[model samples]
Target: VVDLEAIADQSYQFVEWTGDNGTIADTTANATTITMNGSYTIRAEFDITTYTLDISSTAVGNVIEPGEGSFEYDDGTMVNLEAVADEGYHFVEWTGDNGTIGDLTANETTVEMLNDYTITAEFEINTYSLTVDSTAGGNVIEPGEGTFEYDDGTMVNLEAAADEGYHFVEWTGDNGTIGDVTANETTVEMLNDYTITAEFEINTYTLDISSTEGGSVVAPGEGSFEYEHGTTVDLEAVADTGYHFVEWTGDNGTIGDVTANETTVEIFEDYTITAEIEEMAAEYYQLTVEVEGNGTVDIDPDQNEYEEGTEVTLTAIPDADWNFGEWTGDHKGEDAEINVTMDEDKNITAVFEEEPTDEYELTIAIEGNGTTEPGEGTHTYENGTAVTVEATPADGWQFSEWTGDVPEGQENETEITITMDMDKVVTANFEEEDTTLFDVGITNYDEEVVKGENVTIEYTVHNPTDKVVTEDIILIIDGERVVVQEDVTLEPGQEVTLEYQWEAEDAGEFTISTDDEDDPDPVTVTVEEEDDGMDMMLIGGIVAVIVIILALIGYMMMKGGEGSETEMEEETEEMEELETDEEEETDEEELDEEDETMEEGSDEEEMEEETEEEEMVDEDIEEEL
Candidate 1:
């Protein structure tokens, strides 16, 4: 018997079987087998019971009902499909290449997917708009002169009217509206975007003019004035014999020229003007100013003379190479110009002189190592003015003389006085002081010495000066001062040597110096550990003796001579060994002697140099004693 079972899952169902099968087998089964018969097998089949539902939009709109994705559903299950319009579009309908839809015109509908299905949601595009505007002085009505957005092939009504003093002329822009309306009202179709404007004309007005009793109106005939809108009208105020025009008032929106008595007015609306009048003032007299130099004079006034109470500004100008000196006559001030009122007839003079011939420039130049007060460079002074220049020397130097354009015969003095009538350069010469008095030098007893040995330091002091001296003499080792001799006098070219012994404790450079006006060059010595040559030679000799003894023993053992006892052979071997070792020792001793001899020779040369140096020191010490 064969067994068979029907398997049904959430997404699939077992439909049937094919090929080999048994009488008791089921057509649909999850696990089944047929009875064995001549190598045969049965095949089971499965059907997808749940199908996927895919939702999508044609434009940027969303699928509101079943969110965009594949959804699971059983066979013949119905899903509600819907689409929402985005900002600039409208949902049209639901469509597909496969699937059964309930409605074709509806945004919300039911879709039955007996098999796999795919569909699209159709949407329609929306419209946009352009705007229009008119400058000041008018108004627009209705669909008016503005932007309007509508669906394709939509009609919009437009109208235009103007403000109080303006009249509509014509409609302009966007191809002159739908109808060629020359009137203020019209209509347009918004097939595409559009911008438009309505033009208008301004109306005219009359301006009236008048003035105070002391003044009269000149331009515009002094009466009611007429002009088209935006036309310019000239206005003038004429003052009578004893009057002056002050200001204008009354409906004068803006004065064309505020500084003059006459001006023009623009008429956009009706207006009236009035001029204020002021009384006349007292009379003034003329004040004449004269100049006596090659220069110019400037005065501030509308006329040659100013009013009695007005203050006039006077300025004096001078040409190059000239300077303003003083203001003479009516004004007693030393200034070049002065302000005065025209109370009476006055005469004044402006005096100027040639600028003082370019002041004399005195320059001091330094030649050597010294500084000059009234320091280097130009110093300005009037003609015949006196300037004193002094030269000061720095340390280790002295001012010797002065030269170059200085006062006659004053070139040899440290300080010189000169009359600066012309530009002059003076040079100050300097010389170094005669400080070479004593020649002092110090040296170490040896160039190279071993640490822990005593090193003798010798200082040589020589009186290189021509004169004799009884002064304190001091010796310095490194930097520490040690007294040598006090109140000792010596003839010219006399020299003395002082000595000090110092222990060499550290291996390094050792220095010796002395204290004198002119200290001589110092000397340096080096200290270090000394090598022991004898110990090395002894070690070498011992090693050679051992090698020789070993070689003798090996030679005797390999000889194999006839009829020899062990004791005698051994004795002979000892003697031969001893001889070889003695010969080696003698050679080693000779090498050692040669090494010592070489070392002694070098030491002897060093001793000779030291002895010579010591003898020279002894002679100098005797002279000091």
Candidate 2:
């Protein structure tokens, strides 16, 4: 025998046995047994039953059922049942192929698969025929689907007119009904659709083993659904009368109440109970789900900002016939006391515990997946570092490339610097050789100053090219441009700081502008009154003169008039010299003040700049110091 216990439907076994008398005989013996599905064969016979039995035997049965997988649908395949015979007592009469209706022959019955096909012994069915019809259209219907609206509080009269001689019998439905019901008539009183069903009472039947009720068993009717397992799924049982239930006995004894039996089982154990007239199953709604995070949330409508740190509470309401479903995500839903994941970058979903819940498509990304509001931001990562990207445009501008010395492969939203070192300018039409500079800070000669002292303007210029800037840059101030005319060689990209001084003149407002508008702008400045320090000195000298005068008076009183006249002449000469020195100082202060307010307003502009070169130099200085 073949060991087929471990195999599924695609396997089988063949075995053989022999008899005594030293004569090799066929496999069939005086007593042999065969079984199929779960029952033993109804009849059996031996090949040779005379005198001494032969010993030789073969495992293959003379007449054997073919293996599965041969029969199919559409471009059809079939199983050929052959009864093998050696020298035998005449082969008996039997149907080889056509086992049921559409059967033609007694010895060889050929099977032609119609819409559906099944194999059965003609000995089983006597001569009965099954006729199916529906009160609504299409007697062959789906579960929990398809129906027509009828007046409420009235029984939906469904006429399942049986075959010619058959009479109406039992009725069934998905949601079992209750009311006055008999074999033919049914009364419905409640709501809910069902897999409405009805059987028939037939006579002159050849067989009772089977009926042509072989389509899909409708589950629920229009507006209805299947119930959860193990729960007492309530039904509007009082809707339709004469509504019965069809019980299915599975291979495994798992239905209602069964004793301990060690047997294997199939998919479902229970069966569908139905009502005669169905009122579609009803679904409940107003399903509410409440959720809360582990932080606080402040909703800013104008900015669309959600500030979360502690916890938040959210209430969700569903459409009619929907109820709050189990929650999915970091937290399980109960009373909404969910301890959210420390980093839940997505919104948790709450669903209805009903059939066919809706679905949505969401985008998932590891970086640059969120928005940074006007004032709010969230930091996320890619390759273990932070990055941010924006979908909206910045208020007054758009984002342009900042191309700086950044690490390679850095993508959008990575924080990097934009170079503002130099500006693009007109490249030709100059008296000197063509040149270029990199990250150079232009000079601004016009600045506010005080006229009482010499005013100094300092700027750093650079030749960032291989050529030299031979043009003497005339530093213009108040319309008086001063040309350096100094001959100098500036190496490639060489930088130099220049400082210029102007002597004091008449006091007046003067506009100090850059001599070259084609260059960068200049700085605006104020020149206040100069601090000459002469007032304090003059005051001190007057005090000294008073003291000297008093001292001379005292000396005259003590020594009479000796040398008094000589002292007076000396004092007069000293006073004259003091006056002359004071005049010169006053003139210098006045001239410096006048120089500051020169009143000439050339095209004045103020420029401010910060340089990376300055920073690099500072770094070098620190290293040196």
Candidate 3:
């Protein structure tokens, strides 16, 4: 019999042992015995071990060349590895078993399978794209027009430039976020694949303004101005001394009002506008004519303004009972009509005087025991003049009528007028006075009066009989004497009116009258009360406060009830815990009592067993004997 063992070195494994002539047992085992007879041979064999290269990758990537999953190869074999990433993702490096890889930082590398090894291709989401552009009027200067590649979450600076006649407007984009959209130079955050553009716009046009020699542009004054398309601009021109503005002329614009000095223009493109002006044909002069008294001057042409060296006629036409006196200032004359040459601005005055007339005499005669106004003497007056003669009666007489050349409508009046066309005489006749007194009545009064406001009451006193009387005019309110006018006298056939102010003090209806026999019906005045808003507001505020206070009290009572219930529940839980603790104490006492009883019974059983053993020993000793 022979014993053979297969031994292996590092990175090597034992194979089946080869034998000839004799039977070999357990040929595949490393340590096995080979049974041999005479002329027998046995051999132990070993071979290089194979290894599994487990190739895998993280998310969004895979191994391409040596595909994913485990690949078997001999030990110390060189394997090719290549990692491919999907769209919007990049391979980072090889992860597991880094020491076996040739370049750990490269996506495509070689790995040596020295033993059973595992390798991983790591990838990450990183890169994105950006596209920038511009409009026709301008161009983007920074991060220029093109599609650009950048890492994810990158802040890119942007800038835009405009041409000479244009301007940069804003930055626009299809995706991603810009810091400032309206700014010419700004930044953008590249979160995903984005396309951005810088926009621009055309500039405004300039308007040139000027004026002619006689006038100057006042509004939107003579200058070069810039405005947007289809803008309306105001134009105004002021004329100088002795010159006037004619019309507005423009090179390229639509004028709203061409004939007016102040107008508007619509501008669509670059334009130049001018104000046209011209001088006047002739110099003007003013003819100012004034009259001293009761007359007016009339011009032949009757125009407000006159040319230089123009003749104007002055006719001083007098009013009734008046005559033209004289002309003063530039032309001085007493003629009724005159001519004046208007050389420059001239001021003239026309003075007029009364015409001469024949003199007449007015004699006032008294027929009774009364005095006439002229004392029964003759008076001289001009023709067509009116002379008033009044006849006042004595204490016991009254004026009846006027006779002898009195005015036609004033025969019954105590005061009469006599026209002095010729020599005239007037007589004031008087007679014995009657015994009747004067009649007094209320004429006009306010029917409605506000409280604390004054009301006017008008009363008239008339003497119908041919007598003069003096009495007090009394004003009464609500059947009581409130105001009195003392010493009011009424002549014969004469009437007088008086007024009184009475202030309303209370709010009610009151009667107003005068204390006279011929007084009219009493006037009832209603006094109104002023509105007092503050008292009503104060009462409403008190009621609102009471309501709010009651609501607060009700809410506090509800909260207090809820608190009592919670406190009762807490006290009940505490009582339950106390009862449970008492039950546990009773259970512990019962356990202690059972333990003491068992200990006492165990002692009695030990005593009984010892007595039985002693009796058995005595019986054994008897058998031995």
| TM-scores of all predicted structures | 0.26, 0.22, 0.31
Q: Write the per-residue lDDT of candidate 3 for residues 1-625, one digit (tens) a residue.
A: 5666767988789987776724777788887666655566666688888999888999988899789998999888899989999766789999777788899978888988888888888999887888889998888888888999888778899999987667888877663388888888888887788888788887799899999998899989998999876678888899876678888887734888888998888776788888999987677888887767776778787788888667888788888888787788888777878887765788888787776568987877788889977678888998988787888998768888888887888988987777787788888899976543657688898888657766778888787877677866667787786645777788889998888887777889998876644455878888888444423433443354345335444544565655566654654454454335434433543453333224445435544543454344345334423
Ten-residue region with minimum lDDT total, candidate 2? 602-611
Pairs clashing in candidate 1? 5-29
- Model 2 lDDT tens row, 1-625: 1111211121212233432312323333433433333422232221311121111112222433342223443312333433332331222333333443243323233443332343322221112112223443223231122454432233454344455444555565542453433445444433443445555543231100111132212322223233322323222212222222233332223333222111111222233332223333322222122333222222222122233322344444445554455556544664423443212233455554333323321121222222222113222222223222223333323333223232345333324322222221111111222222322333554445565646666666666667765444455556675654244457677877777666545455554444464546645445566555534544554454455445545645665555568865764565455445445544644453355443323101100111232233345334423
Worst 10 residues of 1 by lDDT: 616-625
- For candidate 3, the per-residue lDDT at 153 reads 71
Which residue runs does candidate 2 get wrong by more than 4 Å?
1-449, 464-466, 504-506, 536-540, 561-625
lDDT of 1: 0.70
The lDDT values for all models are: 0.70, 0.36, 0.76
lDDT assessment of candidate 3: 0.76
lDDT score for residue 254 of model 1: 63
What local lDDT score does residue 587 receive in model 2, on the 0 to 100 scale? 61
Better of 1 and 2 by lDDT: 1
Better of 1 and 2 by TM-score: 1
